[model samples]
Target chain A: MKTKTAPVAVDVARPRPGPLALLAGARRGRRKLGRRVVPYVFSLPFLTLFAAFFFLPFAYAISQSVFKQQRSGLGLGPPTTIFVGLDNYAKALRDPQFWDGIKRVLLFGAVQIPVMMLVALALALLMDSAVIRFRRFFRLAFFIPYAVPGVIAGIMWGFFYSPSFSPIRQLATTTGLPAPDFLGPGLVLWSIANIATWEFTGYNMVIFFSALQAIPQEIYEAGRLDGLNEVGIALRLKLPMILPALVLGLLFSLIGTLQLFNEPLILTRLSGSITSHYTPNIYAYNVAFVDTDYYYGGAIAVILGLVTFAFSFGFLRLTRRQSGV
Target chain B: MRNWRHRASLCLALFLGVASVLSACSGGGASSGGVVQLTFWSFNQQITEQADLFNKSHPNIHVTALKQPSGPNQYYPKVLTAVKAGNAPDVALIEYQYIPTMVSNAALVDVSKYGANGVKDQFVDSAWAQVTQGRAVYGYPQDTGPMGFFYNSATFKKAGITHPPATWDEFAQDAVKIHALGPNYYITAFPPQSTGWFQGLMWQAGATWFSVDTAANAWKVSVNDATSKKVASYWQALVDKGLVSTVADFSNDWNAALNKGTIASWISAVWGQGVITGSAADTKGQWTAAPIPQWTAGAKTSAMWGGSAISVIAGTKHPQEANEFAQWYLTNSGSLSIGVKEIGWFPSNKTAQQSSDVNAPQAFYGNQVVDTVFEQAEIPTTWTWPPNLTAVNQFMGDDVNAAVANKTPIVDALDKLQGQIVQDMKSNGINVAGG
Candidate 1:
């Protein structure tokens, strides 16, 4: 196994210097010109699109968030946009609903990210096991739900949650047992998490499975020679090898949990189980659009974006510090 | 190597040049045939179909109708962005409640100019009132959605009731009786998810959520007023007795219950008939419509549920054609009848209200003249719309839901709602501190 790992290490080291050596041989002035000109040529199309959609509107949203709209006496006249620095942010921060949503998502993320990651990891390992049959079929079957659009998935699950339309409910009735109230206030969060897990577990499994495949067979053979079984190999060998992938999955799940919107929004009509402020994204969406308070919505969005950025960057830093990467 | 670099640079330059040229050509397509393609947006599919019908009748007019998805959260930002871009649709189907917001943004075209000869008078007086911003007519009325009681006959029979209840007290009594028949059965399904409907109930009970008559559309905390509390208490008792499902916004449970006859009746919009009948094929003859039992003898003549109207854009290139199309869609008897037959939308045109199709009995509602029943119950139009009607609806929905969820007491929820709505308005620069 150690001998097998040597070739990959050599390959990584050998690829780096060729590009640097080319630059070293160039004339000083030409090197400067090439470095400046090459990246711009490579980035021109991306920069154009970024300017057209993201940067321009991002700037506008930031500008819009700093201002507030006011109407004069009688509220009879048209509202005038007034420039107010940080007031929108202050109002959003002070809002109990907004803070509650933020706190709820954080707790949701803490539970959901680990649960999803662990399930995905377990499934990926099970599929990779030597005794597993029809691996490709099982992998595809698991991945099928990811292909269904979120809105459609929400609607489909909504039927299952409904007593009137649910086949599950009918089956339960035939058995002389009560159907589970999926939309009950007590269990709606977990029900939503169940959906997110069903939709994404396969996608995450594919990620972990790919990471598992990259592990050479020789390492497993060595573990076998040391009398390590498949379970031992997974615990001692496979798990550590897939740490980066696990971290990647965890980060994605965290972000997804924070930005949860589509399922809850679509499922609103299925049961009175969800409110407009159920999730932070939904809260921002409601404030911005339904409430017509774009300034506050923008503030909430900015806050959420910052939270996502902080969590992502903070995780990357923590992983790097721990792994010594 | 040098030649390769030069060729690569040329390729890059050529790629950028072609991209810019194509983008310019696409921008040019925005204006074509010496005509500007004015975009019109609406929430209702029926309204979009009606617009399409009007466009067909009048040639040389190209109005693109964009439907606002059923949920307002997904719809309003698109309208806001389009307006902010200085390229909003030349005409839009603005629901009556949304006129104030559109007017506030200075995004609407004043249709009052086209109505120089009292053309605005052609619509139901209250329908016209929704579009008016201090004497300037902003849009033409398209439909009116007066509230009514739509009951499932099968469920009623099961409860041993021969007629739909005629008063709130009787309604509750019947609801309790229905619940007694089956453990999970409910008398009626309402959007316990929304406070807007709660406010409508308060209105029926002779109280208003806000002081709409005041210069400032400020919260008067009237939801806790005696009559309003009575309305809330009745519903609360129903919920306590398990006579009403503790469902949030119209969820699958609500729809399934309605279709399964687990819910005996529904207090819904004049337009809800379209959704209910359209979604359930087997329940056609099983349903019927009656006047929504009044809270008191004359507390309210009626309370509206849903309605929308069309407006021409102020800066549109084809104002004349737009005006012609708007007038035809809103007031023309032929065009309005098409809206009813094709899409089941009730027309707001006073003349069309008497049309054979408008007055015709619906077979689905046990062959009752459901349309005529809706017209007769038309509320006196005392309630007015705010620019932030969507927010008002949302807040109303949330606070009421909190009460229903037992997360807060009714008075506490109302107080919370009052504070939040007022604070929200103030943060948005609307003065709600005083009337």
Candidate 2:
């Protein structure tokens, strides 16, 4: 076997020598070069867009975070932008409202993420099962909510959550049940969470469903042969296989929770519970726009971004370690 | 292969070049007929219509009005961005409360140079006070919203109340009597987010929260002074006693309460008359206007709440034309009539207030001359807003809401707000007194 393989390897490795062979070699070299350069050429547009829209703004925000706009005595002149390195960041860190917003979102995500992901996972599993009827219709129905824009969804849910106009409240009253104040101070966060879940569960469900589809059918067959039922197969085989997708979904939810703005902003008119500083993103927006203090706003935004990145990376690392990858 | 690559790059370059040129050509479509074109940003469509009227009358100068979003939430940020970009409109409509902020930021032109001083006597003293800082006049007052009590007459009659309360003592007694009618009923809703309305109350209570001394170049921030604290404590007691509901203003809940006759009155502004008329149309002839209850009996003093002004922005090349249009839009009888009749804005010009359209009886308030009540309510002692008024108002609202919801003392909230306003002002390099 060694003698046969050695001659084959030598023949494959041998260089061509004739003029026609040299011409062919030159052609192959050109083709190889083309193959190496084509992908970068194809990606140039995307790279340009990413740099322009994402990287440039990110760099600008970083620079802006270090400077502050100061006015003269009595603030009766045009504000002068001056360099104040890390001062804005320090002030942001000291702001009670900023911390309160961060804490509120952290609490919001802690509860919202698990509930949203579980519902999405359950729906995905149901659709992936063989016993389900009208699978296509069910999938479409589950995914339809992901198509609705966030602002439109927030407005729609605002009407439903409104105590005066909510059909839910009317139904509750007619049925002799106590009416729930969904927009009250204690329940407003959960109300926001419910809207977010309704908006994004379908999106996460699609991710999970696609991941489930990519699984080899042979593993399920083996599980069936081993006397494992559907639930057992889902828990033991399918779940572990889709762990990476679950982590990806979790990371997306984590980042999204930190950037909460639109729902709370619209809901402010409906509910007194949502203040200008209800969430970190809202606080940053109020600081930058309402207060016209973009320096501190930029600092808060950068800090939030860093926190999101760190949390997601740490989570990914933790999951990889637990999986012994 | 190299030739093909070269041709592909050339094609891409050509495409980008064409696209940029197309985008560039699509902008600046203003008329260039030797007419000086001036852009004006306004929150109301009435101003745009008035500008159209101006355009028809003036052949040499053309004014284009761009309607901005109504509230400060979106409007001020857009103005700031435009000003920063140095591409702001020549003239813009700024609310009276925001005039100090705009002036302090130097976003407005000193229109006194353009005959603004000559027309000072055209506007009400309080309205003029809003636009002028010392000798520098920044804008012409467009409208004012003096505070008033919009009460439900039907509810009052049902509760056996004969007249509107003349004092806080009488008001509190009336609230108790009104609440006695039913468990679901309250005298009024104290909306936590209604900082402007609350400010009007403070104003009526003689609380000078902000006072600027231009000669000294200093600001007196007395947000939690004795008078303001008294106002806070008084409301706190009412809220604590559950005599007033904590419904947010402009909310469906508040409207539902009003429509159902659960709330007896709205302590709002002249502009609120239109809002109530529109939102609670079923309660049309049942509603009536009265002076807001005073701290002392038989007092005629009142305070201003919401209003706006028209100003030339600092960077405008056509300051003369912009000021001319502003003066015309505000002072001209034809323009004033249009604003009063078409737009719901209460005129800031004394002559405009005296116009027949304003003096005419309205069907909304049971044919009462509601404008007369507002006219008297624009008292000279109305509170002046500080340069940092927006931030101060927001902090007050947030803290007040927290106090109301958490059952904490409202005076404590005021104290916290006072500290925050001082810190915020000082951080912005404003010289703050009583810090």
Candidate 3:
């Protein structure tokens, strides 16, 4: 937390000013070097951490990806790490399990994100309308699910999805209705999506709401002068105005969905439907940690990294193009 | 587009954040004043009782046992993290199934140097072979899982069954009789997700899933052989006819089903007695243990479902102390008696195994000496647990589970995963026979 602010505070609080301070005096010029160096000194801790935690590990993973551990002669001893030169990447490229995991999350994202964003957009718009009572209470209530961490939310919903333990199932059965098996093979992916939607829609709604709040009242006034009704003005003017916010929300959802891990993982023990490689993140986690196949796992991570980048870039471009019209 | 660096940074941070956290383990164990402070990571929390006794008796070495929960995820990674830190717990309780993987990772120190060979005659031959790869001994054989047929006698009587099934032929007949008792009744729930349980069945049928060809320097995988196929088809017939319930074991539904007497029987190992009694507490005196039903009428063979060994980790600062503790605790009668009470560990140590503490009649089990019943079935100590058992088990479970739900043949599941398992081993640089 301190790392974020430290860099900015360090940069601004330097004794020497910018080039503009050179005009003051020679004494000031002499002190300028110390002032300029002060920012780097303060940011050094964060930068060092960034290098160690991010850059070095990134480099290490990259190094590991091109190499794999090899064994021979009953494979009893410690395996020798060998340079295979993209062999792991090539193997992962053809791995049905890895691709299946990727496809699963993509489908999860495709259905979950749009529906979730729609609900978020509706909630954001309703709040911005100022026609609703207990606005603060509704906002707080919606955001509460997001405050429950993903793992806890997953475990909580896992209980709800379980047929034997669920109150919903009990009520349904008592009413002489056949209870739906939420963790069944056909329904589990969507069940996980429901958990994600519940946890994240509120957080994304807050984002959309804040962006809507940033809009000027003059735009709506202008719409009113054009003989537009409240609904008409809100739909045509306010919606287009929050295009950037919508794109941001979509981007976050896309990223979140692709990295789907927690809910499915928690549900795994309860559900026979979810496989070991249920999602790319979970697959990578299991391969590296459980299976101890670090090279392949690292390759999967980097491939996922590339895929995430391409999706974000493409989504940003598409939204930008649409906004231009 | 403009802040690409920032976005990429955030994404990478999110993805790699968890993996990098593994490097943050700080290990604590020190030898001061000639007293070895040893840490033992055990999933069986009750083992701490033995650790307390070990500390008290062995004045030179104080063992600190940390309770680690067992699962596919929880137990392994914590030990791996400490292995990475190079100051791992001196001793850790790892299941026999996982030992090969740990050995391949070089995460465990071979105790052969710590007079392990001298005490070789003290353990079950198969268990000793399991802990050793060639001449190198990796751990001390602690508890073993020779299975038994645990049945609800009341349910059997209600179904008009006179006695427990002594053979697979009779087991099937009993299944039908039980099914006739009620629409919901079943002979036993086939744990769809349990590869260990299934493998135990295969083991019972004398089906060799894995074996090492020392001369060829490769593992011979015989998963879908005729022997195993016969076993699979026999079980599949039961599943297809709705005689056996297909429930995920350790699940809420299975627990409820067992409690309600809808699920009437189990063919599980020694520790499963605890699971049965713990889940179906109301039916305390209704249950009893028998020898695992044989393919042949009087065959005394059984398959193991669950068991673990006490292994000294590779990077321990006190290997001597660790190995000392592992050897003493596993072979010692004191530890066995303590384990018999605190944990339901069926001893691999032959001497302590015959002790009264282990063979006593359990009240919850209808005054049955459940231990002696399971001891009659001979467990194959020579069954090779492949280094890639986690993947093997995962793929097996995946195939078998899908097949059970889809009404597909169970042997097809074995044939389906055979290639995957072999390929997995080969990719890991293991020499697979005919791969």
Give the best candidate by TM-score.
Answer: 2
Between prediction 1 and prediction 3, which has the larger TM-score? 3
- The 0-to-1 C-alpha lDDT of every candidate, in the order given, reads 0.73, 0.84, 0.84
lDDT of 3 by residue, B1-435 (tens): 548778667756754664456444443676789988999888776778888888888899999888887765557766875686576788998888888878877899988888899988998887787688668888888888888888899999999998999999999999999999886799998877888888999988998899998788899998999989999899899988889887777777788878888899988998888789889998989998988898987779998887888899988888888999998888777788877766888888888777888878899888988888877678765577888777787788778877875667888988988888888888777898777
Per-residue lDDT for A151 in model 3? 95
Q: Tell me how far candidate 2 lies from the true structure as C-alpha RMSD in angstroms.
A: 5.3
Q: For model 3, which pairs clash? A: A16-A35, B126-B381
Instruction: Give the TM-score ranking, best first.
Output: 2, 3, 1
Real interface contacts reproduced by model 1, as a fraction: 0.42
lDDT (tens digit, per residue) of candidate 1 on B1-435: 688899788867867786887566433115467544556667656566666676676565666777667563455556765666555667777667667767766667776677523776667677777777676877788887778888898888988999888888889889878988887788876556554456666666666655553644453434456776777677777777677876643555666677677877878778778777865556878998888887664433567665787777545666666777777776776667777776677877777776788778788878887776676674654555555566766876777765666545566666676676665566555656352
Q: Could you give the CAPRI-style class of model 1?
A: acceptable
Better of 2 and 3 by DockQ: 2
Candidate 2, B1-435: lDDT as tens digits:
688899789768855865686467444424477788899898676777788889898998898888887643678777876776577888898888888888766789998998898988988887798888889888999888788898999999999998998888888999999999987699999988888889888988988888776676788878788999999998988898889888888777888889888898999888788788767888878889999899877787778787889999977777888889888999888788888887777888989887888887878789998888876663655356788766877798788888887788888988899899988888888887645
Model 2 Cα lDDT, one tens digit per residue, A105-172: 99999999999999999999988998899998988898898899888888999999887789998899
Whole-structure CA lDDT of model 3: 0.84
| TM-score winner between candidates 2 and 3 | 2
Error of 3 at B413 (Å): 1.8
